[model samples]
Target chain A: MIFLSTLPGVRAVKNLRVLFMGEMQRLQRYHIIAASLVVAVIWIGVLHFTDVDDVTSIFPLLLFLDATSMSITLIGVSMFFEREEHTLKALFVSPITKGEYMISKIIGNIVSNLQTLVILYLYAWFFKEINLNIFLLVFYVIVISVFHSMIGFLLAYRSKSFTELLTGVLKYMFIFLIPVVLEQVGVITGDLLTNLMYALPTKAALLLLNSTTNGVETWEVLYGIAYLIGLSLLLSVVIRKGFEEFVAKESGI
Target chain B: MFKVENLHFTYPKNKEETIKGIDFEIREGEVFGLLGPSGVGKSTTQKILIKILQDFEGSITYKGKNLKDYGRDFYEEIGVGFEIPVHFSKLTAMENLQFFMKLYKNHEEPDELLKKLGLYEDRNKKVGEFSKGMKVRMNFVKALLNKPKMLFLDEPTAGLDPKNARIIKNLIREYRDQGGTVILTTHLMNDVEELCDRVAFMADGKIVEINSPKNLKLQHGDRKVEVEYEMGEKLESQMFSLDDLKEDEEFFRVVKNHRIITMHSKETTLDDIFIDITGGESSEES
Candidate 1:
């Protein structure tokens, strides 16, 4: 970790994380957090209407925190607010490098986004028979939320405004939100989709957490954890470097 | 305090050059004005000097050293007040000031500056609620918090009321009085004439006219006196060349006999001299 930070540009990554968290405190907003919690509670309540095993169905609510909440709601909305307010120019004049700024967003956003998952987990504790390990559940939520956030960050960075980023995310059913649907339906449970799911950082996190709680071997969970870290780190670097061409000189207002 | 020589800059996409070889020098404790119209590259010039926009083609030497030699540590030496308001609107005025103050080495009392700018009463209020004039005032306080030796002000008086403008200009003068140098950029003739010890008029990305405002006007001004007087209950006006009037008897007698209602010389304004020197209009577009 010291070696990574000592490298030419990675030192800024930590400060960027700190600043990003600060920005999230100001931008993620209290209303949105409250609203997301309400949605998750309502999602769990919907399980009471059906005769489904409520414990198994309630896990969908936790997965939704990573799958739907951070992707469309938190990271996507942050870009929208920044576009509306137009503080990006001010950021340019300061000594805070773009790399540092992005890292800050990642750290701040990833943590705050976990609030919904925490709320859902506690909500399930009081309402349903949640058989999952507490520590593994939180670690799963954090890692999975961060992965979805980066995907959202990449899209949000490309989007000019909140409306545009939102509409862009909404307009695509097959490309953007497919992963969310594929996880919920009982039909897409074939080997190809399962392999595809394993390749995804969020799915890998969710699968690893479920398997560990189900008394899976230590080696399998660590293997899933390794894959999750490798995928997210690789995508993060690629996104940061590729966006450099357009980050400073955004095309439209 | 600063020097820019033969600086050439063109934006990445544009074919036309924005800044064309501007040369100037600023000494300590003096207010140097970079007066020009919009798209004349005044801001670009400042950016290059302050190291905001790198990759320019020219030599910028500060305190006898290349600007490129210094790193982020150099930002501690100066305070830059952008022409537009640049504050974290979510925070209070003091919060914004305090955050930026930590980034610099030399710091000043934030509350004292707030009082100086008449912003102490509203120091804890959120910046988003501030009016345009109040925000500009807050912006000035942010710049001065570092006790910078060299200050860069671009359109510093924008959106400020006359009283607020006067306060800001006075603060600038006081900053100079304390041995600090300032680079003021504006199209406001009044600000240039009042605050600048020396003014440079830029055109076509190059400085076409440079001198003290008084000297520029004097050099291009008509050396004639326009006198208005009341004679036989009728007001009369006449212009006399200062050189010819000294030898003309009637001109001398008219001034010596009648009480002068108003007497003033015909002097060109800084703007007028600028148009004459640059051979075109010099309207500011900020």
Candidate 2:
């Protein structure tokens, strides 16, 4: 506790709990959490009809999509609501720091991602055959969601409208997430191309998620954990800078 | 509580400064009005004082400490009511107030404030369902929720019936009597005339005039009393210098020999003074 308090901004994190609770409440009020549940049911439907009774191979793929894409989309949608309602402008004048605001949103996004994970995992366990380490999956989902939430912040800061934010996410999906997903599904083939997949963060995410079943090597797990954690730290700094710029613009500086 | 000196700020995308070098002081416990037309930099200056915009070129000392020396804690001591709506549309009025109320160490009771503002019955209604006047009143309630030492109010009564506007004005007076400092920005000269203790008018990013509203009127008003009298089925009027009217025989003759239709001193309104000093068209809210 003392070490945590000694961190630069941690001691000044006032109203973080209230802000996080408010975020969660608004997510429910705006039907965002309901939408996540609907998406989770869709994932459950996909798993139910698959031919393979042992669902270990496909479980990680479902989580990878949820933890990465849903995380970004949820943050984007919530922020756009704030922008539309001008609630962000009100929050700007409160006692909460920018760090606290961003952390609350990230934590709120993690809750939604975790909900999807729990729903899908419960369905697979009760209705089908599955084997994986649940604790490790939870950890990987958190890390991946945090990284993508930062991406969401960047996209939201630059987007002028909700449609523009969706377009930016689509561009990101095409460039970074699609190729890695294609390689994972056996659509693209080659030793050189397969090795180059390591450059994409989504590949690292999939590797971490896939490691729960014990096929992935120890070094690959370490690399995935390190890569995602390190990239999240780097993006945090960029996201903070972007937040300052956004505040300036919104304040009519 | 704030003393700003030679303050200058430019937007990142603009080549010229929006708040050109200007100086002003907001004394504690007094309502200081920062009045101007559109594009005159008053809003930019208010944003700077609230710590929303940094990188300003000069110095601002709040309570004798540099404004930059303050951080997130600065917001704990100040509250701002923006001109536009700033609440979550989907949240109930009470919910919106409660969410912001908990963020401050010192907070007022939401129910009491809502009742005072005549919004108690609608506390459970969503803010998106509120009328414009209700939303404006809600903004006021939110600004006072923190019990802030200093308040920044932008058009506190912009959209309201006369009765509601008076209620807001009376509440402002009561808040001032309790020793709260306020920085008000509004184009409505009537509000300024009633509420402001001192006013500064900005023109082209510079403070062109600064004084009490009465003083500004005195400085810009005509120094003659216009008197109209009924004479032979017509009304005849004449202007007498206020300085000599008490002793002038002509003024006495006019008052005694004729039935005076109307007679009064010609004191200028703040609206006329605003236009005269700022050299801008009146953007006063109707």
Candidate 3:
């Protein structure tokens, strides 16, 4: 044990892997993965009745929703469940760091969300003959998933219960979806509004997802990638800080 | 093994300090129990020692190094069992234990612990399906999974039946006999009396009294003995000062000439001392 403690970097990586695997197992055991798949099938079923041309337009929106909005909502629900069970207190006493705990949640949510995105893409390909940049799609999915998972942590931290978290998620969606809806309908246009929209993580995610399906200008694609990455990093730091405070308060410390 | 001096803590929203300046020590291989009433900063003090609550105004040395100087490695040698069971309800008991066990370098077989706690039959069942007592037992298993050097338990057997509670208390004693230190916090006076080598009573965030159970009992008890004897067809009782019982003619007469039914020293109970020292706030029982 003394020798192992001396090798902290190795121990940290090992603990992180264990934590991540545990989170993934919890996601599966709770039927969250099956629920995500069911949601994908439902969306694809709904689109199957629409015209093929309409499918092309709706496909990016569905993928973006799964990557960002749905990921955040699912992560929030998972966090509240853990809090209700008082498992967070158990985690705090383990050898793993708080940063590892936060990252494992982010990584776990991304993996689960990515699985849903793949199913959606397969459905789109079978019916609509969709062809796109798979690498970029996956990259944006990870970035957007981490970004939204951080938001989910913040929501869960402030909420007193799962019911309160639901209300907070609704409020968050209403505010964040406005810019995305305006951009999608061409109601907000030009470099100024688009540049301003980049400030919102949801809008930035939508821009990146659109770049994968529909053609995007090189500069816009670069800007979307940089904006989401930078915002996700900032949110990660803020969420870690807030998480420590929330845990201290919730644990009655 | 641990030395805490002048410890003080104030919650951010509170107007006054919750843990007023206090000092105590936990010797190695001994069960040191912290007893106090509700909201008297017992849990807060435990949290600080466990490193869950930082930014405190004091110094705590664990194994000769300052506690603050330790990092995540500090938890590697310590195990904490909370008052309430903390487990993933959706997962099976074994799964929960396995997941936690992997976080530490040292590992103990969960099956052995579950069997000892009578939980092996239901090890494959989800924790959410377990009874409250069963969940509490699982919490004990979780705490011991790492083969911890020092164990911190809060109400370790609050909801167990006599048999189960005895099993846990015996395990605690065995742990101590094997050179492992323990910090126990509970409202169960029986546990303190049976397990603790020394106890500290806290009232209003200060150590009002600290001593061994036997020592405290002796200190608080009246120096008298109660003697009951059968005299011809009647049972009578007499009280005698214990200090001069050897020279008391009445006590000798009753013991020599009459049928002595019962003779007992009136030792003060830990419960009595606790209530008296903590201002008679009834200990909360679950």
Would you estimate the TM-scores of all the predictions?
Answer: 0.83, 0.95, 0.95
Clash counts for all predictions: 8, 0, 0
With a 3 Å backbone cut-off (N, CA, C), the pairs that clash in candidate 1 are: A16-A100, A16-A103, A16-A104, A17-A103, A17-A104, A20-A104, A20-A105, A21-A108
Please report the candidate that would top lDDT against the real structure.
2
Query: Against the unseen true structure, what C-alpha lDDT does each candidate score?
Result: 0.70, 0.89, 0.86
Q: Interface Cα RMSD for all candidates?
A: 4.8, 1.8, 1.6
Which residue pairs clash in candidate 2? none
lDDT of 1 by residue, B1-286 (tens): 7777888988778898888888888888899998776767776777677676667887888888899897655666777776657776777888777666644445899989999999999999988899989988876787677777888887789888888899999999989899999998877888889889998887889999789988988899999999888787888888888879779787778888877799889988877876787665666544
Worst 10 residues of 1 chain B by lDDT: B97-106
> Predicted candidate 1: interface RMSD?
4.8
Candidate 2 docking band: medium
Off by over 4 Å in 2: A1-14, B284-286
Model 3 clashing residue pairs (backbone): none
Cα lDDT over the full model 3: 0.86
Estimate, for each residue in A147-170, the C-alpha lDDT of model 2 and write its tens digit: 999999999888999999999999
Model 1 segments more than 4 A misplaced? A1-21, A28-61, A64-76, A79-86, A133-157, A171-174, A187-253, B243-248, B278-286
RMSD of each candidate? 4.6, 2.6, 2.3
Give the TM-score ranking, best first. Answer: 2, 3, 1
At residue A165, what lDDT does model 2 achieve? 97
